[model samples]
Target: MSTTQTQMRREIEEIPTAVDRLLSTSAGAIETAISKIGNDVPFLMSVARGSSDHACAFLKYACELELGLPMASVGPSVASIYGAKLRVPNAVCISVSQSGKSPDIVELTRAITEGGATSVAITNDATSPLANTATATLPICAGPELSVAATKTFVTSLVAGLWLLAEFKQDQELVKAIRALPEHLEKAIACDWTVAANAITGQSVLTLGRGPSFAISNEAALKFKETCQIHAESYSSAEVMHGPVSIVERGFPVIGFAASDAAEDSLIEVADALTEKGALAFVTSKKAKKAICLPHQRTDHWLTDPISTIVSFYTMVEKVSTARNINPDAPRHLNKVTETV
Candidate 1:
């Protein structure tokens, strides 16, 4: 096996404890970062790209419900060298990155700090440019991920970001709930992925969701495309119906993630539509994929996504990769890290 594959396997097994240790050691930092935010901060605005950007979507939902704070994702243009530019102030601005070296992420941290927003960063890289620039930092502590596709780092970011919400609000209940994440992930790691992969083998897969689950769908597809080299796609449920729905066929495996959040009802409507098209859509609930019929848990989109996403993603990636005799950790034309414009 390749070194990349070995690292991914290790992370799949080791990350549950890393999360626990990070929480225990960084409780103080989490508390300090939250104390710096003011009530005048209308909402939390986050800056990121790729997987980190998707994570920001979930964090956005958590801040609104868990902290009673409205949230938005910064256009990320202002952070990037090329794109439209806008900035938010009196709001807590967060940048999530694994390497903390993405040009856009680094610039976002600098822009917000200069613009007088309370700049914070969550990253796995300790001495990264972003870590030095942020007013406060949350080290995700996912350890060294030598694979191009993010696995444990993304999960840890969700954990670290959720803890940030609880710390800011001193939300004991939510904090307590987060401690169970390690166990939840263990169940996720052990899931049977072969069947799902076989369901859509050699065909394009569509990962669909609404609200926070929309972001989860993106991350799920990211893993499939990046690791398994499959032609997987992700779309917002409403948007999919608009034009992308034409791509779906009976042979296609459609993975649906509906979170316990504001857009749950809309997602349900979409799932029913998928059935009408004769596509086998599998929906994931908090407790496995069992309660697709139950109402969503909370309006916190961020809180619910990782619960459902991590599991479904693990299964889908495994299924596709094993069927092709490919190791997900080692993909053609990709290394563990990249520096691209």
Candidate 2:
């Protein structure tokens, strides 16, 4: 069967439209939350797990870079397991979940809301317990994702969180780029990284990114395991050489995701170095010398570029899974919504 016939592939294809829906319908709620948080919030805290947590990581970078505010990921166990209340006054707490029904997520969001932090929920369900507990909600509007693995919802959550940060920072250029993302994503979905896919002969691979793209790398690594049954690990371009590069052997596959940002050159340099070591490295930048260059769609803002790259990677991974005779829609021992305490 063609990869396009799979539920995962269909959901991956819906990412552009899903993001467009979120951009159009979520502005009012996002604006309202921005007004509630005001301009003087000191710091931000994020609570999430799995793919949603990866989206939070992406937003953490965006918030720290664009708004100049410190951001940290808070463990949900502080509230759910330890029952300790945090004293985060004048801070915004962002919770992300595709399914807003996760017990730990709901409990932590409630705890933070009661502990003097402005709570914001980015979720697909508007009436979930998390939504009811938060001070404001930014529904992802990804619609019903039927696949066990999350594709459209994950991308939409990233868009919603970034949109909130852009509105908060009053970055008009970034906001404009975000509004134009659906078109860029459409172009990204058409990008073919078949050369990179064909190079994955090893059972294990490394995915590298820097700054905001680091979070994208995390999501890519997770998807590689979930949909393609590949043992993939993600690392920051800066940190990989410190410890992780020791494992790279000749012909080992590596995929580096780099955007048009200050860190782009540095990341590409790492990819080139790996390739020079006889590893089969693929990078999404034209600056690569020894590493194979993968086709990528660039957007106006650096933050949005990773989103497009991920959409392209999703397309490529779906094909890879089907080629291996594995169903991307239904992986081994996985489910759609995992609720944990």
Superposed Cα deviation of residue 297, candidate 2 (Å) = 0.2
Candidate 2's residue-wise lDDT over 238-291, tens digit each? 999999999999989999999999999999999999988888999999999889
**Model 1: clashing residue pairs?**
58-302, 260-297
Tell me each candidate's TM-score.
Answer: 0.86, 0.98
> Model 1: per-residue lDDT, tens digit, 1-341?
33344445666666677777677777777877877777677767788877888788878767776767877777555556664444566778888988988776777678777777888889998789889988888898877887566777887888888888776777777777787666666656665544455676664788887765777888888888877777889998889888888876765577778765667667767766775786766665443332133222232324644554565466557556656767766788876655433
Off by over 4 Å in 2: 1-4
- All models: lDDT? 0.71, 0.92
Candidate 1 residue-wise lDDT at 153: 82
